[model samples]
Target chain A: MTETLKKFVAGLELDTRMLGMIGALVILWLSFNMFTDGRFITPRNIFNLSVQTASVAVMATGMVFVIVTRHIDLSVGSLLGLIGMLMGTLQVHILPQFLGLEHPLIWVITIVAGVAVGVIVGAAQGWVIGYLAVPSFIVTLGGLLMYRGAAWWVTTGQTVAPLDSNFRLLGGGAEGTLGEGLSWLVGIIATIAAVVMMVLSRRQKNSHGFKLKPLWAEFTLGGIVIALILGFVTVMNSYPLPKGAVRRIYEARGEEIPQFAVMHGIAIPVVIVFVIAIIMTIIARRTRFGRYVFATGGNPEAAELSGINTKLLTVKVFALMGALTAIAAVIASARLGSVGNDLGTLDELRVIAAAVIGGTALAGGIGTIYGALLGALIMQSLQSGMAMVGVDAPLQSIVVGFVLVLAVYLDIAYRRRAGQ
Target chain B: MTHANAAHPLVEMRDIHVSFGGIKAVDHVSIDVYPGEVVGLLGHNGAGKSTLIKVLSGAYKRDAGEIFINGEKVEIHNPRDARAHNIETIYQTLALADNLDAASNLFLGREITNPLGFVNDDAMEAETRKIMGKLNPNFKKFADPVSALSGGQRQSVAIARAVYFDARILIMDEPTAALGPHETQMVADLIKQLKKAGIGIFLISHDIHDVLDLCDRASVMKNGKLVGTVNVDDVTDDDLLSMIILGKKPGEETITS
Candidate 1:
């Protein structure tokens, strides 16, 4: 039976580590559902869980590259806080004064300004790390403190609120989602794209006379992917809008409320996370930049001898991390409809934890964007699960801390065994 | 194979000087190689042979010198510039990224890309397979990282990388140090083939036998200075050892081709 199972796994061409992580996730979800008496697995809770995971998950994907390149950005959380504050100030105080309070372009300008600040600040820090030859740990730690102070100074530690309504949609709410029809359409299109990509890759391998997976194995993998995407879309489409929200929509539209409720297919923030995951995965796998990052991490002298501009690559990687933090800030602030100095406090730890648990080696040269996303999901599940089980805040923190160490220890053991 | 005397030298490093802080790693050292000629660089530890060659390979910027390729002066401030002039080096350390597979390390900076500018990994793997098949017929572990390979396998991977790029100027630093006798013979044969193809090679080695068997000429360095250059046929093992050990040139009576 073990031999047959091994053959089945090999036939699917799946990474054993990835399968293990998925298995763990399923088990975790089942236990959580049991603890909540089936409440945790409901469509409503799952949707909320997805939205909650989005912000950290987005940043965690970028952290994979950072850690893979043998660097750390201790400043990401503070950077998010600073960017969120800047954005809140722009949309709330500055832009409204110029654009006359509710201009269609206010949200766009605010977002652009926030992202610009993030990239510039991030690149500046990268310059110091790469060109100045300073350790990344020290530089980003300084940035952590400096940016947190800067965020506090933005509004003298006061909260900025009443942001532009359109911007809030990016944070994902009852109205900030793709409806039932659009969500299914997206899932179908994604499924088709994935199959086409697999087929094209197989053809490419064939042309090059490389080994290929069997046809039945390929079909099975395709079937699995289709089932996953469709399953997710189905769950998302089952969650109907709350009664108050439905009534408000009718009242705003000057129409009587319908007897039936409309489904909230998928949150905008969740879609953003998925899109970012796809883009980051492509960048990590297909681009020369990604290759150089890993090569430099593996051996800096080798990369330099190979004609790679490793210093410049470092700067670019850090700048990319900064940009991602800014996006996370947008989601965090928009979700709350306000920005405070404490908006992303302690988020750096969560981001790092997620990346580590996802199997980004601190020693550098290996990581996956998808793995980091899954890691973030696992972290959020643990936190929310504990909360639903009425665990105290301190106890939740203790469990998370223990789980983080345990997961990494297990991952290291797995790697040692598989590699041997 | 004999290099043409009248042919322009494939590589010329004129009066190269490299200093680190207050120490002179290579001082006023000059060397040249003609097409189809292999010049062995012999030296003691810290004798500055590698430093001088690094100037030519663009691994180290010379404080003072000019590099000429095929009689034309060229700027080689970095490895990219060296590669542009078709110069490739296999260092003593076999500078392969340990985390990457053979194909990734082979193509490295110069990857095979599709029209969309994405790396064409399959094409690179196929090319790597073809080359490794010729270079080391037993090398079948293409999917494993270089770190997992045996020392000899890793050395061959480094050699294949330099050879695959069609380098006009090849630098092999202790290329056979990690190889078994059979692999050493294979490399010697490969060098013969590369030399017959008119590639200029700088072979750095501690083994006098390898120099005698493979190189056309030998250049000895001591205390960051070149002692002398002599034809391999004109010098015996003791004569070269005297030059490396005592900073002395071969006796006048020993000057014979």
Candidate 2:
């Protein structure tokens, strides 16, 4: 037990950002419950918070890459709005006749179109920054205004609403009883596959004459991850929308079991956010491209002298950021069942702040996708919990702004101390 | 002193003149190096010994001069041209990125890539180890970044890089400036190894002891002008210092002698 305690402390120390964020989260939760008379801790509120945070967190993952390169994308919010508008326009005007596509296929086409637009815009900005040697602040600042104007022009300053039911299913719909069971099965299989991969990688490293972490370290980390997943499943099962709640649909249908029975199972948006987080983490940690990103951030001149095409790497990072912004835009539009010129207004600051708070250095060379996700969660929770406590929207914004400043100050202090 | 082709100089610079911002940094200087020879370039802080080597390394464009490599006039306008002409310079700053490993520094700006278009780490490591073995076998920095390496080890890596790329003419600026006695010896041994390989070296230094110990010929400069090149065997440290300080050969001028 003493050894286990020591190991846990060591792990927590290794993950300073996560531990700090978790502490902040706990504090925020307590304050929220105290102010809301415990309503903030309700299952319904938690589910709503998760849904709302997903879009920003997804966007924040990409923002981390840009920030790590010591660059800023002030235009992410405007770009997201523009992409969302474009997606809505495609669905309304182009999807049915131009492609002869049905519901789900049309959604896919819309997403692809959005992402393509994002990539083009990102590439254009990246080219200017990388080749022309324009400051990212100026380039992305120009992008902010330009894309916002384009979004307004595309949508005619109006909201596009009444999306197809299939499209709505992506954001608002929950899994059916059978679907929940299937998701649980898929989740278990994925966990197993991940474990196998980790074991294989460890073995490969061992064979290659590299030092492997102690078996206990590896097993403890793996076990904790599995435990978290199981805990999540347990919480989901206990919710009112559990698979067991699907009996209500059968009762209404006057049948022993309803064929279309649905519970308030995990929403697609939640699943999407989780999957995107996982994939982004993998991409950041496991790929050569990811290593290049870190290397470029660490010392661009050194990287260049090492024969790394830093210009291309910068362009690729921005392009990836754009693609992620588009994905976030789609999710936001789907959740709202509409798209508007104001869809992502001021979200850029929030995402950047989240990344910063999560320990992404303003000076570049240090950051992680997981840190950005946690940062987004902290920001989103503040907003959601404040709302539950009857705080006005503008006040909530002020609070979030103050927290962002505090987080940045804390980060600076930590960095200085670490240096000493 | 008795090496083969010692009569035929490997590199000859005639009336080399270089200026920076209208100031004559190297004015009417000439020097030569024979195969397997170490030519020490001596000067005060601004006496233009470095400027002359910069011209040779193609880091600076000479205003008026001609450089002959093996009796053929060569125009070197850039580092690439210098490399093509087998001229390599190891500056006082070393020019090795500290964050990179020895292998990466060895292949910086020209990495060997694999068939899949990624840097060939194994090949680079093998080449680095092999070359380092010849230069400084005691240098145990195989994978560690150059930043962590000692001054002598860093110099070893820089020298290995130049030699590995087939540099026939090597220019070293203050190679042992900051090194201790042992480290300086390590570099001196490496320089001897280079001479044995038939690579002509330009050893730039202010240390007369180093010049006497390592150089086959000592060339002193004063106020952007060549004093004279003397066989190291024939000159003393005080003679070289007099040439540097008084702007005249030690015995050739009555005032100095």
Candidate number achieving the greatest lDDT relative to the actual structure: 1
Among all candidates shown, the one with the greatest TM-score: 1
Q: Model 1, residue A195: displacement in angstroms?
A: 1.0
lDDT of 1 by residue, A1-420 (tens): 999988988999787788888888899999999998999999999999999999999999989988888899999999999999999999999988888987899988988888889889989988999999999999999999999999999999999988788899889888788879999999999999999999999999999888889999999999999999999999999999999998886798899898987899989999999999999998888989988988988888999999998889889999999899999998999899889879999999999999998888889988889889989999999999989989999999999999999999998898898773
Give me the candidate number with maximum DockQ.
Answer: 1
Per residue, candidate 2 scores C-alpha lDDT tens digits across A55-90 of: 888889888889877799999999999998888888
User: Could you estimate the TM-score for every candidate?
Assistant: 0.98, 0.76
Model 1 scores a TM of: 0.98
State the weakest 10-residue window (summed lDDT) of model 2 chain A. A171-180
CA lDDT, every model vs. true structure: 0.91, 0.79
Give candidate 2's error at residue A35 in angstroms.
4.2
List clash counts for every candidate, in order: 0, 1
Complex DockQ, candidate 2: 0.17
lDDT of 1: 0.91
Q: Candidate 2: deviation at residue A81, Å?
A: 1.4
